[model samples]
Target: MGTRVSIAVVSVAVTAVALAGCAGEVSDVERAQAKVSASEDAVAEAQDAFDAASDEFCQAGESYIEALDRYGDVLNETAPTVGDVRTAGADLVEPRDDALDSAQAAVDTQADLVSAEQELADARAELAAAEAGPTGTPAPVDTAMPSASPLAPAATVDRVDQAESEFDAALSAVTDDTPLSDASELFNSAAVELEMAWLRLFADAGCLADEQQQQAEAAVRAYTTALQQELTTAGYYTGAVDGIYGPLTVEAVESLQEAQELPVTGTVDKATAEALQAELIALGGVAAQDAVASTAAVQQTLKLTGFWDGPVDGVWTPELTEAVAAFQVELGVEPTGTVDAATIAAFEQAISELQQATPTPSPSSSDG
Candidate 1:
């Protein structure tokens, strides 16, 4: 498996690598190197995980096979007193079969991943080699270019705030009777994101001397802590939250993300963080029926307007609200948070009319 690093490259170019262990400074070269290092580490860890998962998957499979052999022995040793007893005994075999199937599937998945990561490591190494050649695009001479992100400061501030909030929540979640394995991992990731954001800010602020090293250290910490928090939040808690992106956290985040139906880059993103936060909140608060219903409705509305997927639990979110406002903008309706009678009536009519016109899976929310 080839490793793909989805790191956001610094548009601002730096001719050389930033010094290590500085508080809040970084160059593009350092950023690139850090990213490559992360990818390499991830591929290595994924290989280890594949090995571990294979062990468990194989062991579980063997256990099931042994159970089947034992069952066969028992069947040969004793005739069932009745047909129902034999049927019940046969039913016991189903769980064993299911276990074996699941284990083998897991083994297959891990085998594929190991291959993919090795391929990626090769591709990246080759790219680095190519970049070294004379024909390669010349490294930019400037490191002072500004970031091109439209939402730079605001986004950074938002990220830092989220990091702090998630940290506090994760702390509480882990300490609570019901440990929040998911939120803990994300909080750590957010912490890393904050560190990354801070370094970017320092670079943008023209911190050239020692801030460079500080920023590099911060980026490492940001990525590492995020990985750690994710691991803890998954049922795979390893160690203390030391704000270091080590091997254990990387493996844990990848596994958790895999379980959560997320991209397995092992890097925590916005959606993953949000889902983790939601999970922690759920652990704290009793999920109300109305909340689930509202979430479903939001999902329905987003899908209707081509923003959301199928599930619509009624929990209102900023995205859902913004989406609803956008829908209202399109429909010439008031952009209120509540889905009032007017909005529903309009949606109902629109969905009915659309479905009536096109008998595809484009049926309205009302139909559901």
Candidate 2:
């Protein structure tokens, strides 16, 4: 009886050990199966994301293509105006950028989908090995997958750049047949482009090692100053010939534009410049313009010396002539009512002497 009881206990112990081992093996296989399910879900989610991104990319690409077509239409128009071309080019910038951004997103999501598919494949292989026991060879995973390639961003960039170049060329192609307002529009467009290009190239710190920025700005400023000078000669601008494009300059430009039957945008454009040149030509060209500016300077100088109280307009009257003659006499120069190089030299010398003779006042002592 004792031997039989011992045998039964040993048998029960062996059965329990076998069951436990079986449970552990089943758990491993179940866990691998669970991993495969999770990987499949991940792949599904990545695929959905890729689909959405692809749709967005397609829409953006279509819109960009339409924008390009519109731009082409504007360029191909017979007798197209400057304003029309400029507006079309401006409109193309946004859609082109949108398409590029969408294409990049689509490429990135495609890469994600590819990666997720690889993970799923690996998980399935692992699950198969787990089900087949320790001696079974795992199925091969597809590791040699193609990488996600970029779609149209590079070609789009090149095409857009070419379009912008062509647009700029079209804007600058001026001829005698171009209308006055259209010519002004071209100038306005070119000036805006130059300003934007300058900001992009030189507005940041350390963009250039030297004074190129200042020189570039000064070049534009020189043009403004010359414009003001011409407007002064035309009896439009009465303000100082400073390079600043102030409200006075705008007002003068508008007045000139209105008189010439051009658009009154208050900007110093090519038409306004031509009108100013015509006015100068009517007044006897560069020589007359210089004389007017010099006369205005002489009038200011006479007012400073208390020899004249007339308005410092560039117009010459008997009052200005008498003032010049008196000033020449005071400076021991010939009493010429007309201003020449000698009169200008004599006035400059007199002013220098006057400045030197002026006394500097000392500060007063404080009482304790």
All models: lDDT?
Answer: 0.42, 0.53
lDDT of 1 by residue, 147-227 (tens): 222212565445435544543453344332432234333433433333333333333323322433343334333434443
- Model 2 Cα displacement at 16 (Å)? 28
Q: Can you give the lDDT of residue 7 in candidate 2? A: 34
Q: Write the per-residue lDDT of candidate 2 for residues 1-368, one digit (tens) a residue.
A: 22233334334544554576665653557666666666666667777887788778656655654564445445334456757766776786698678668767877777777776676676677777887789877676565653655443353344334434644665556444667353443333332332222222221212222343333333334445566787787788897674444445666777888998987766543344456566777788573555344345545555555566667665556666666677667766557564332333233223222332222222111110
Best by lDDT: 2
TM-score of each: 0.27, 0.37
| Deviation of model 1 at 320, angstroms | 78
Q: lDDT score of model 1? A: 0.42
